[model samples]
Target: MTDRSHITLYSGGHKGAESEFGQLAEQWGIQEVNFSFDGHTSIQRTRGMKVLDPEELDKGNVSMEIVSARMGRKFAHANKIRKVIQSIFHMVNNGYHVLAVGWIQPDDTVKGGTGWGVELAKLFNRPVHVYDQERNGWFTWKDNAWTAEVPELDRDTFVGTGTRNLTAEGKQAIHDFFTRAFGPA
Candidate 1:
């Protein structure tokens, strides 16, 4: 219990992660943040997504002349991304960790959440934990087993074991990952 206030649980925030984290957050008192776009916006930027000019998302404050075709559909995402970035800042400024758990794709690169979750964690000197849904276990940025070993991910090393559940043996794999990632020193 290291005052996980600064820790923002950054992840895909998928259903199981969300469900489990909700309970874990309540019991452990943790601040959590996630990147989400229901086929629209992203926390920062994504290809094919319509990037707003800040005014489009701010209807009440900044009036726009003509709403773009993508404005209305992307309004909620704009707001959501704003809040998530703000939360990341809060955790970083306050000195916290961001526990990242998300989908690991083939080719061994973070498809999307990697930038928001892994990159930020590295920048802020926080620990990041990744979950491999397909493998059903914890994985690091590097390991020969990784589908595509990333150099950036490999350059950094971990204080503890990177692969906690090699086989996805049990239901408590993620829980165990938290224990190793944020547990007492």
Candidate 2:
């Protein structure tokens, strides 16, 4: 098995998928960095947590109009979501590979805030993977289409973000992913 000591997982450390990723990263001896902002209370992983200040958060800011257009949906609480979106930018920006656990909508976008990170990964041309909970399979973005594949953590740094309402399958997928990449944690 490849040494995973140097691998770092960048995430938002929310309750479900992100928290599972963080926990698995710890179990596998991989470094983890969880990005957060003020007034954000849902973070589950505190290890290596980096609370982004307003200025740093602003660095990742984009117009809500652009985000809505890109996401193919509108945010009712644009002001509240802007900070989360900005923090996601930091997670995606710092990580080279993006792995998400969510539903891939018909529009070819992963669902929820995780979708924003996936979109950014696509726009940045970084390798992106999604373990669709609904589909119960892994898909990788290739040539503008999501192709089925068993993905591994090929990069030293990667972003792990996904839905807050993670299912048992999603949790197992993250565990299996780490096992496949690192073996016997």
Candidate 3:
């Protein structure tokens, strides 16, 4: 029997976001979709019975203008950040590690939820690992920033190079790293 590990993946639908993580997850038989519901965009692609419709949201009588105003921000997009936080908790409650898949820029900086999620994870004192495409290795929160040695990824803005896929070796490293982190499950 295969020891399948449940992990929450922080990434977008782009090739760069999903490439290495998706490959490694598949190789280790891990699942990225932790929560799925109707009209969740990914529901059709995933098998989930939990149904979620906007009827309740509509009933709340919340204005789209308000939503748009809050969701659209200069530095922090409320929707994405809030969703990332919520999903991080959801994944943790369901026994899944929060993994952020991102890239490192030529100048070395990370933005968006890929970077912000790690910040939130640190505040929550949770374990957050990243498959850094730029450095071509696995990183974890430790001390005050991302480190490849010891244990844990610390708080720091991840480097970025924009959306990009991982190489074959990078993908394998992801699998190996997770195995070491979780150990047989």
lDDT of 2 at 51: 97
Report lDDT per candidate. 0.38, 0.94, 0.44
Worst 10 residues of 2 by lDDT: 1-10
Better of 1 and 3 by lDDT: 3
Q: Give the per-residue lDDT digits (tens) of candidate 3, residues 30-142.
A: 55443332334532123222232344223323333443333342443555334333433333333324465565333333444354444445555666666676677666667
Off by over 4 Å in 3: 2-33, 42-85, 92-96, 104-110, 150-169, 178-185
Backbone atom clashes (below 3 Å) for every candidate: 4, 0, 16
What's model 3's overall lDDT? 0.44
Better candidate by lDDT, 1 or 2: 2
Question: Quick one: best lDDT, which candidate?
Answer: 2
Q: What lDDT, from 0 to 1, does candidate 2 have? A: 0.94
Which residue ranges in model 1 land beyond 4 Å of their true spot? 1-19, 28-83, 89-96, 106-109, 113-115, 142-171, 178-185
Q: Cα RMSD (Å) per model?
A: 11.5, 1.2, 7.5
Stretches of candidate 2 exceeding 4 Å from the true structure: 1-3
Model 1, span 1-185: residue lDDT tens: 46766444433233444435434543555554433334443232121122333343332222221111212222345544553333333333333333334555554443342234444454556544456556565554433343331111222122111122233332365456545555632
